[model samples]
Structure formats: structure tokens, C-alpha cells
Target chain A: MDAALKKNDKQLTVAEKTLIDTNLLKRISNGDQDAFSELYINYQPRLIKYCSRILKNDVALAADIVDEAMIEIWRSAGSFSGRSQPSTWIHSIARFRLIGYLRKNKELLQDESSEWLNFKDDALLPDEEIVLSERNRDLIKNIGKLSDKHKEVIELVYFRELSIKEIALMLDISENTVKTRMFYARNHLKNILSSLDLTDFG
Target chain B: MNKKQLKKRIPIEALKLLPWYATGWLSPQERGYIQKVLSQYPDFRSLLDAERKMINVVREDKSILDKSCLDATEIRLNKVLEQLSSTNEKNKKASKGVNQGVLVYLSNLVSSCSPKMQYAVIAAVTTVTIALSFAFVAPLLDENNVYYPATSGVKKSNNNLTTLLVGLNIEPTDPRLLKILDENNAKIDAIPSKSGMHHLTLSVKLNATQIKSLLKTLRDNKALFWFAGEEF
Candidate 1:
């Protein structure tokens, strides 16, 4: 399995990977099943995380959403204009589907409000915190303390490793808004860490 | 001003972009600028390391989806793919329906024309169609005398080769079938993949009357030919 994965990776450059993805979409547009399967394996993990977050950690629901989004990809691949990165295009489709699901279930309203309410100041007790690396654990805890808007930018950049432009395009926000959110989220995370006596963590 | 002072001096914009820098998502120019800043303020290197560590920590929390969920997703994806295939086939059939609609539309348009104009248009279309057909068919017409399709008269040429799709009554390997075709100066050009059919090329440049005679000759041999018809 490891050898197969390494062969699959092939360690292509980012531009090469994007080019391959664009080519795959073109093939998918022509109803190529093998191309769709290759794209599915490449995107499943990240898409699961992205959709799971938006759907409030409902991994099963996120997988269903991912399936629906993949179906949309297969349907509309011919319409991909290649203006944006393929990753941006695919993530935008997943975001649109997830938002649509939330709106349909009337969960968007509750989700927005509950997102802030769900931020627990005490993410881990003192004893539980000792079980993990205090600095890494504190950083994760503090990141969770951020507002949904701010936390999204942080997650997109730090965890997903998306460019500012890509995240802006995916979220339908300006690049300035993405940067500003990251800025505020960073400061807010720092303050939260400082208050928790993890000031020197950074 | 020592290490603490230099660390404090790091730009807020640079700090805001540090996550992207650590993740290598920044452009070359932005990365260069960040690298310059980090070089000038060596103490800020710790912050960059911390950023990298922070990313690793966040990515380490892989509780989002398990293997079972992903396996289920693959099954669901296959279902979607099945639906997509059937949908595509339906779409192809619907597109054919659209083509048929276009033909109906053209027919209606033809009907809207005056009788004389319609006749003129039809005549023009028929002329063009026949001209195109002949133009395409002319290349296939070799030195061999070309036979038109069933119910059409044979076009005689110098070489009197007539191709016929003959259905055999007896087994193909039967000697009587070869004897009858050999008597008529016809040889099997190709044994068709379909059952009961063979392409016989008759080298006797026969005219319409002679072809009729040949047909009668084959019909007389009930043990050999079941059905025989000329094809181009």
C-alpha cells in the first residue's frame, strides 16, 4: 500500500499537479470514469475535512455532501473555464453544495450563531492538557477559540495550506478580507494563549 | 535593542502572512520579502518555527473522517457514477430526439413555402444530394462493373464484376454452392461474419437482362442459393 501511494504521489510540482488535475477534468468532461476515480482519491481527504467542518463535524454527512459535490463535478466538468486553479474550482463546488445543504435544512442560521457559542474557553482541563504537548495542544485550543469567520481563514491557510487568493475565491470574500481575518484570528489566538499562561509558546 | 526588540519590530503584515509563508503558499516575491525580514530579525525565526509546528499540530487532529466513512463514500460515489452513465445515455438519446425535432422543423419550413418554390427547393436539394452521392460513390467504382443496390439496375463497365449478397440455402462448405457460383463465373469475395450471407463477385459483365438470367439460373439451383441480391 505504501509503495502504491508513493507511486501515486510521484512528487510532482504544484504546477504539474494542477495541470494534471485540469487534464483530468477535461477527461471527466468526456465521461472518463478512470479520470474521475483518480481525482476522487486525490481530493477525498481534504474535501472530507472541509465539508466536515462546515457540517459541524458530521463526517458521515460530510461524506454524503462530498459524494453529491463529486457528482456535480462529473456533471459540470465541461463547464470549467480554467480561469481559477482546479483546486479552487473543486473546493468552491463543495462549499456551494455544503452551504446549500445547510440552507435547505435551516441549519445555516443556527450554525452561524452556535459556532461562536460552541467555542469553549476550557478546551482541556489542566490534567488532560498535561497528557499532550502543552504548546501544540494550547495552540489548537486557542485556534478553536476564534470566531467562525476568523477560524476558517486560519484553518484554510495553516491546515489546508491554500493560497490567499484561493481561499478568497472559495469563500466568496475579497483577498483583503481573508488576510484581515487571518490577522485578527492570529492576534485573537495569541491573546487567548497569553491569557492561558502560554505566552511564550510562539 | 537586542533579540526581544528585533522580534517586536517584525511587521504585522509579515506576521499575518507567516502561516502562508510557513506552508509555502506565498508567491516568490512575498516569500523573498518574508525571508529578508526573518534574516534581519533572527529572533523572529522562532515564530516561523512555531507557525510550522502549529500547522503540524492542527493537521495532526485527524478525527474528521474515518476509513469506514470513506469506504461508504466510495460506494456512494459509484452509485452516483452509475446514475451519471445512465443519465449520459439518456442525454444522448434526448439529443437524438433534438436532431429529429430539427428535421421536423425543416420539414415544416418546407411546407410553409409556396408549391412552386417548394418543388424548386426540393429539386435543388435532390440534385445536390444525388450529385454528392455520385461524387462519393464514384471513388468506390473501380475497374469492376459496379452493381447498384437491390431493385436498382446494374451499371455495366468494361470489367463485368457484380457484387451480390447471397444467402446460402445449403451449408457454405457444400460443393454444389461452389459449383453453381463457378458455373456463373462468380467467386466468393468475402465470407460475411453474419450467418447465411456471402459476398459473391460475379466477373461476367452482365447487362440487366443477363443479370435477370443469372438470377434465374441461381433460383433454379434450389440446393445452393436461398436469396441473392445485387449490392454496390
Candidate 2:
């Protein structure tokens, strides 16, 4: 049984994932419409969800952000460097497009309080795992208290699974700056969760 | 090492490194530093644990995002494919039309040149015949006092010859004749005929030299003339 489980667990490694994604990117770069379509089908759902979370569950706006990001992916797929994971690279693209959408429509972001409440309620319910539930509720609440910059870093690096280097490139900031924002964001979350009585939740 | 040194550490300013640390992404040195610090401070140990949990929660949320985004992307891809197909069709039609137009224009051009060349050859032949006829016939008519067919009843009376009705057919419209008449200070009576011909009765006294000069000028100018006179 252990051997069977181990075999099942031996899925594609990170390097293998990167290789496959890179191959797909290379095909896309060569104007292979089928390859590009495959990429779209593979990543669009994740991108839309990321945008929705970042943009505070504005589904229509999230859809627009996802569309814009995919269009950019289509245009710039030929330039994909194997320097990062394909998902990380694509997450960065979605983040950038989401920020632009938010900035362009500031009023939508201002009305995001209701969306944040929904996100917080929904976030707390997804994980039945005790540790995950406590941590998720703490994060959602603390994220609402963060500055836009700090929240952006946390969302990209932690939530979106982008590396510090990838986040730096996408935000057009230094790696040091990304680190600084992340550091403060974590500290802030820790303080916020501490005030919420971490033992009671545990 | 000292509590003073530890207090001054200020969370490594590189606490930014914690996100990478939570994900087990740190280099050995960085991880060692963090571990050394965490061992020294029990509070930091708990903080690191909390940070890892937070990162996990975020990762879970992100995973959900992945699935939804892919669904949205499928719809977008379909739209793009539709647009590309339409553009390809339009481009194909445009190219076909351009090719057909070019072929038709070339065929018409090739066909048109032969007829145009034929017309040009006919025009050139007609021009040359006219030129030669004028050169030969003009001098002969001018010397013989001939009346051109286009003019009738215009006559020149010759004193040395019998008083026969000597009708000299000359083109009254000719500039050379008009100039000659003007030079001699002569007048002629012009009568218009129904056949678009003009009849002129000359009233000028002409010596042999003047008559010869007038004939030479008319011949040089290619004025046509003919004789319509009483038969002897």
C-alpha cells in the first residue's frame, strides 16, 4: 500500500512542469493557435479567480482582467523565458492587469467593502482543516487592514504563489522592496491575529 | 549573541525573507540565520508557524483562483479564434480579387495594343500620302492656272491669249493668294454659291513677272488650282 501511494505521489516534478509549460510557450510563440488555446483553457480559470480575489470579487471586472491578461499572454508568449514557472509568470501578468483595472476604476475599488465581507465569509468556510480555517480567517481580516501596496505583495507572493523575483518584475519594483512589503504585511497580520486571540480560535 | 545584539537585530529587516522561508525556499545560510534567531527567541518560532499557516491559506485560495480563471479563458480563446477565422476569410477574398483584377487588366492591355497599333499605322499611311500628293500637285496646278475642284467660276483673264472665258479654279481661302492680291493692291468680286463654293472675278492688271511670282508663291504654299475654260 505504501509503495502504491508513493507511486501515485510521484507526479510531475517542478522542473518537469516548467519544461512542459515552456514547451507550450514555445509552441505559442510560433503562432500555434492550438497550443495557445490549450494554454488559455489551462490557465484562464486560475487567472480569473486571482483577479476576482484581488479586485474584491467583482466578477465582471475580474473577467475583464482575465481577458486582458490572456490577450497579453497571447501577444507576449513568444517572449516567455524559462527563468520562472509558467504559472508564476502568468500570475504576475494577471496581477498587473488587475491593478491597472483597479486604478482605472477607483470607484469600483472603493465599493469593495461589501466584496471584502463576502470574500472573508467565503474564505472562512472553504477549509475544514482547523489550521487552515484559523489562518484563512486571520489573513482575510488582516488583509483588509493592509495598505494597498502591502496587500498587493501578500496577494501576489503568498496567495498567487508568485516568487519574490516574479512579483518584483511584475510590479516594476525591486526585490528588496517586495521583501520589505511582504515583511511588513506578515508582521501586520501577526499583530492583527494576535489581537483576535489566537488560542481561542485554535 | 547578546540580548542587546538580538534587540538591535530589528527582525532582520529581511523578515521579508520569511515568505520564502515559509515555503522552504531559503538558501542554507539564510535558513540557518532564521533558525538561529528562532531558537534564541521562542516567540519567533510561533510567529514562523503562524506565517506558514498564512501562506498555506493564501495558496489554497490561489488554487481556487486557478480553476476559475481557466474557465473564463476558454470563452475568450473561442472569441479570438472566431475573429481570426473571419479575418482569414476576408484576406483570402481580397487576395483573390486582386489577382483576378490584375489578370483582366493585363489581358485587356495586351488585346488593346494591337488595335491601337493598327489605327496608328493607318493614320501614318494616310498622312504620308496626303503630304506627297500636296507636294506634287500644288506646283503643277499653280503654273497652269487650273481651278481646284472645290472652287468654281473663279477665272483669270490672259491678255496674250484669245478672249476665251478662262476660268481659273483657285482656293480663294488660301492665305498665299490673299497675300498676293493684297500686295498687288487688287480687289476681286466674290460671289457665294449654293454649293459652298466661292466665285471670284479678278480685277487686277498683272504683268508676266508678277504673274510668274504669284504662281511661284501659290505653288510654294501648296494652293490647289484647276482650269475651266472655253474649248478652242
Candidate 3:
């Protein structure tokens, strides 16, 4: 079994996953259906969460967008220059698809704004896990309140786990600009979280 | 160094990097500086700790969806890819123009060449031992391996030397591809294999510079076919 398949180890390290994904992508380029299936299964959750965060409260649409993005991946598998990690490339596709989905459903998003913070729950999650999830939801709600540019940087850093250079590529900006945006985003997040703690809900 | 210099607080730029450092975004040099500052300044250490906790909080969404979402996604994906695969031949034609967006993969083979390396690459391409391959390095075969000054014609038979693992979806005889190959001094031989795939082999002798030029040429072209080999 692959290390990622071991019972107590559901998560693989970034390097391990990147190595595995890179090999799979190469195989996928050769019209390997099995390799494409493996990529879909591995990336399904992260991309779902990413789209969920970006579009906010649209799980069905998020799922569709991610599905569309995967198909795009299958078609574009040949052009993948090893410039970014496979995961980052996957996220970039999802991000573009998410933008289109968002534009298509802008009105629907505003209608669901109240329910945007309601994340799906799992029985397997513990009490501390529930509290953390709630905190994450609150934080993400505040993230939605940020300027679009600031929100993008923070989301890319925390959700996508992209580095400065990767973020630069995705945004078509410079690495220095990425750093500056990240600095402001973090500061804004700090203020928002602090303010959240002082509200009546706190 | 004086005691005051050693005891000075972390600078503002270093402080600004705390969040980036926590997120593993800093360059190695910046990371090292932040680590040194963290060791010396307890105040900055606490800020770094806060940043770590915040990032952890941001990343804490361990929510995996129910089986229903999975089923839905798989069903939809199958519907889409099945449609795509049925029309795969048609899609391959369109895919060439679709991926032509300005973003090229930022590989070191294209971007990091020093001026001297660039000069050497030009010298090599002009000299053309060009295997300009889609895969691995192979030796130049017989009198057939010739660089065209638009005068020397190519050997057309199975006589061309073959390097295995040239991967791209387009057929070897695509007009655009033939144009690209002719423009350069490279050729591809389409070998049918038992694997139900076009085991297209890029045929030529690879010198260092020709390999680099081939990479640049392939990258500069807006076509979607990608090769999976690492840089030579």
C-alpha cells in the first residue's frame, strides 16, 4: 500500500503527495484512465473545500465547478510544465472555474449569505474539532468581508498552501507584491478575529 | 559588535515576515533571518506563536462531505469525461488553441539560463546535433542525422534513430507539428505499440544547446501537447 493508504495515516506530507501526483500526472498525459481516476479521488476533497470557501454556501455548485475543473485537467494534462506542483496547478484550474461559477451565480450567493458560514459536520469529528470548525467558519466569514485582493491572498495562503512564487504565478503578479498582499491580509485577519471576539456572539 | 546591537529589536521588515514565515512562504534567507530574530526577541517569538495559531485556526476545516457529495461528483465527472473521451479526437484538435494563454510553466530549463548559458545554447542550436526530443537522450545515427540550412533533405524511412517515450496527444503528422519540426531540425517517428497508444518517438541526436533550444521552441509554441521528461 502507498504511505497515504496506511490506516492511521490518512494524510501524506506535501513532498510525498507532490511526488506521487507528479508521477500520476505524467501517466495521465498518456491517456491513462486509471491515473486520471486516482487524481480525481485524491484531489476531490481539497478542491471541494476550496470552492466551498471561494463561492461560499454553494456545495452543489462547488462540486460541479470542481468536476468541470477535473475534466479540464484531463484535457490539459499534456501541457503541464513542471513549473508548479500538481496540486497547485489543480488549484489554479479550480480557481478559474470557481470564478466562472461565481459570476454565473452571483445573485444566488447574496441570497445565501446568512447561511454561508454553515459548514457541513461529521459525526466522526470530536468536540475540540467542532470548536475549531466553528472558529474556522467565523474566520472565513470575516475573510469574505475583506477586499477582494486581500481575500484572495489570504485564501491562497491558508487554503491552497501556495508559496509566494506560486501565488504570484496564479495572480500574474510579482513575488514582492504577493508578500505585501499577504502582510496586509494577515493584519486585516488579525483585526477581524479580534473584533469578532468582542461582539455579542462572542 | 556591541551589546546594544545584539540586543536591538527585530526590524519592521523582519516583523512583517512573521506570518509568511509561519506559512512557509519566505525565501530561505528571509526564513533564516526570522529564525535568528525569533531566538533573540521574546516579543517577536510570541508574535510568531500567535501567527502559527492563527494559521492553524484558518486551516482547521477538517470537514469531509458525506458519501452523497462523492457520489454526485463521481457521477457528474463520469458524464463529462465520458462525453469528452468519446469526442477525444475532436477535443485534441481544439485543445491546441485552448491552452495558448500567456502562462507558460515556469521551469528552470527555460527561465534560469545565465547569459553565458544562453550564448552556449545559441552556439549549440546553430551547430544542431539537435535531438530536440520529446523524451530521453539518444546518439546521432548514420549519415541521416543532418541539420538543414534548408538545403539538406531528411531521411524518410525507418532509418531515423529512435528515442523512446516521446509523449504528446497529437498524431506525428499534424501539419502544425510538422511545420514546427521542419522549422527546427527535429523529427518524430510514429511507432504503433501494443499499449493502444501512440508511442511517438522523437528522433535526433541531442547536444546540450539544441536540447535547450528545442525546449524553448516547444514552450513558445501555443500548442497543448506536453512532454513529461525532466530537463537534460
Candidate 4:
């Protein structure tokens, strides 16, 4: 698995990895609809994930935030500077949009823990249930069991790839608190994985 | 650097930062140090893989609706882009029209009169436009304008005191109608009627006796149909 992932990662040069988005933005500024489409296709899913993670997988709300952000991106594509990675810039934009969304709907975020209670259960397709390996499927099932605080840290750190500093600022917590939560999250995740199977921990 | 400094600088806690390393969020020197540590420490490679695997697993699980969301986003973004494009086009046309109209007005004003007459020109244009609009709408609103079709033919009549009954959709001017007036030397005129029907006219020289004969002929004429037993 490691070798396969390494092979995939090696296909893109560092320059290609970092500069392709910058180049896409440059093309977009010239009123290139194709470039805009390409960029939207790439960013939309990731932004949706980011927004939904906070809104606890309210996909409709997530989609709304993403679409609004995309409009703002299209209108201001010319103003993008390469001071930060494209993903970072986009994450910031999505973050700001989420902030606005939450400010408007304070009630939704109040019960974030309950928002995704049935999410993983519903996300499973019948074919995936048949075809996915039991271990990985069990991992997904177990991820849903973690507490909201631990799950939030794990998702923001490992899945979203947000820096601890950024996550701290977003959650209005200290950096040490973020790190402490990450440590507990990793330990709890390992415990969850170990509980799924015996041989790995042994 | 001293051996103590080198040992202190070695990145032991970098194992904990593997997720950030994978994300490329670390500074260049920190990344290099972490790389060096991982190269020397084979166990940490597995740790990195495990972190990477967890990231992939979580991302995969969270992206359950990626295709549907992407499609929704594409449709929405395209709509927004289309709206922006059309609005920009409309604004461009409107501004262009305004610029051209202002230029033409300025040129006409410069050529037509002194600066003192500019307000007069504008007032005249406004008044004429209002009058033209009123005239255009008045015909549509009036009842009088709805009538008055010269079904027989559209023509003016010069002979005065002409009377012709529009008797029940008959042939407009049958030969018998003129035969009744032929004894009086009736002159059929092509002049359009000012008030109403002028199907046939008799000269005054025909006098009352000829008129009586013409009336008798019209009353007994089989070519005419009398409705309600009235002398039409």
C-alpha cells in the first residue's frame, strides 16, 4: 500500500504540484471558462469536505458555502497572489465562508455532535458493504464512535491537513490544547483500530 | 557546531509532526531535518505511512458524496458565471448606448443653437415625445375610431343631401339603385363621405316630383329587402 501511494505521489514534480493551481488561476483571470471549470472541479469536493466537517456533514449547507466561495473565486481570480499555496488560500476562503454561515445560523452549530450521528451509516452503499474489506469498513464504522472533540481534531489534522495553529485559531483554542487533543485523538484512534483486529496490535 | 548542539537539533518530536510533514506545512529546514531523521530512522517511515494511511482513509470516508457535490457545484458555478457574463454584456450595451446618445445630443446641441437654447431643445424633445406617445395611444382608447368602414368602397362624395340605406348587407350599389335615381339625373360621386354612407345622390333639379317617383321606385323595388316593414 505504501509503495503504491509513493508511486502515485512521485508522478507529480514539486513544481507541478505547487504551480499547476497558480497557472490555472492565471488562465482564469483571462475569462477562461474552461480554466474556471477545471479549477471548480478540483476544489469543490475538498471545500465541501472542509465545510461539511464543520457543519458535521450537512452536505446541502456545505454545497451552498462552496458555491458561494466559487462565485467569489471567479469574480476575484485576478487578485490571487502566490504568497501561499493554493489549497491554503482556498481553505482560508472556505473558512471565512463557513464563519459567515455559522454566524447566520447559530442554532445549527449548537448541536454539531448530533448532526452527523447517522452520517457514516447512511454514507455506506450496499455495494461497498459487499465489496469493501471488513477491516477498512470497520475502521470507518469505528471512526463514527469517537467523541466530537477528538473526532474534530483528527479530521482537521489528518483529513483536512489544517495546521495546528490554524485549527487553534479556528476553534479559538490554544496551540498546546490543539496538540494535546491531537495526541489523545491518535491514542484513541489506535485503540479503536486495535479493537477492530487482534493481529496488528499483537 | 558542537556535538551537544547537533544532538539537540536532531528532530525526535518530528515523528509527531508527520501529518504536517505530509501536508508540506513545515518550514524548509524543518522539512529537511525531518527527512534526515526519517532516513536514519526506518521505524519512523512506518509511522509516516500509518499517518498517511489514516489521512487517506478519513478523506475517502468523508468524500462519500464527492461526485454528486461536484456536479452540483459545477451546475451552480456555471449558472453564476452565465449570470455575470450576461449582466456584464447588458451593462456594456447600456453604457455604450448612453455614451453614443450623449455624444449625439451634445453634437446636435452644439450645431443647433447657442447654449441658452439647450434647455429649450430638451423641453421641446420631451414635449414632442409626450405628444407623439399620447397620439399613438389615443386611437387605441377611443370608441369613435372603431367604426366607419366604407364597405362598398372608400371614396369621397361631393353631392350634398345624399341618402342611402345600408339595407341589410345588400350589394352596395346594385344597378336597380341607380335605376331608381336615373330618372332624376343622379350623379354618383367618388368623393369620400365625411359623415356616413353616400351610396347614391340626386341633383336638386330632380325636384319633389322626381323624389317622390324615386321613393316609390325604392319602396316597390324587388332588388331591396325591407326589414321590420320600414321604408329603408
Top-scoring candidate (TM-score): 1
lDDT by residue (A28-113, candidate 4, tens digit) is 77778788887776666556655666665445456678778876676667666675556555655565566556544544434342
A95-188, model 2: which lDDT tens digit per residue?
A: 5465445434444444343233112223222112223323533333333355567667777766566777788899999988888777666654
lDDT of residue A63 for candidate 2: 60
> How close is each model in CA RMSD to the real structure?
28.0, 41.1, 23.3, 35.8
Interface DockQ of candidate 3:
0.07
Q: What is the TM-score of chain A in candidate 4?
A: 0.50
Number of clashes in every candidate structure? 1, 20, 1, 6
- The digit string of per-residue lDDT tens for model 3 on B102-154 reads 22432344467888886776677645645454122233233566332221122
Candidate 4 runs further than 4 Å off: A1-14, A109-202, B1-77, B97-232
For model 3 chain A, give the 10-residue run with minimal summed lDDT.
A116-125
Candidate 2 on B1-232: residue-level lDDT in tens?
A: 5532433453764356767777766668878888877777765665566677766654555432212212223455788777656766897899999999977875665567788876775677679889988876564463566744322222333444322111124556557557755764544335423222233324555555754555444334422422111111
Across residues A104-184, which tens digit of lDDT does each residue of candidate 3 receive?
Answer: 444433424313212222321232222333454343333334557877787788777788788899999998888777775
Candidate 1 wrong stretches, greater than 4 Å: A1-12, A111-202, B1-73, B108-115, B119-232
How far is B160's C-alpha from truth in model 3 (Å)? 37
lDDT of 1 by residue, A120-140 (tens): 213222222222322432333
Q: Where does the lowest 10-residue lDDT sum fall in candidate 2 chain A? A: A118-127
Which is the winner by DockQ between candidate 1 and candidate 3?
Answer: 1
Q: Relative to the true interface, what fraction of contacts does candidate 2 keep?
A: 0.18
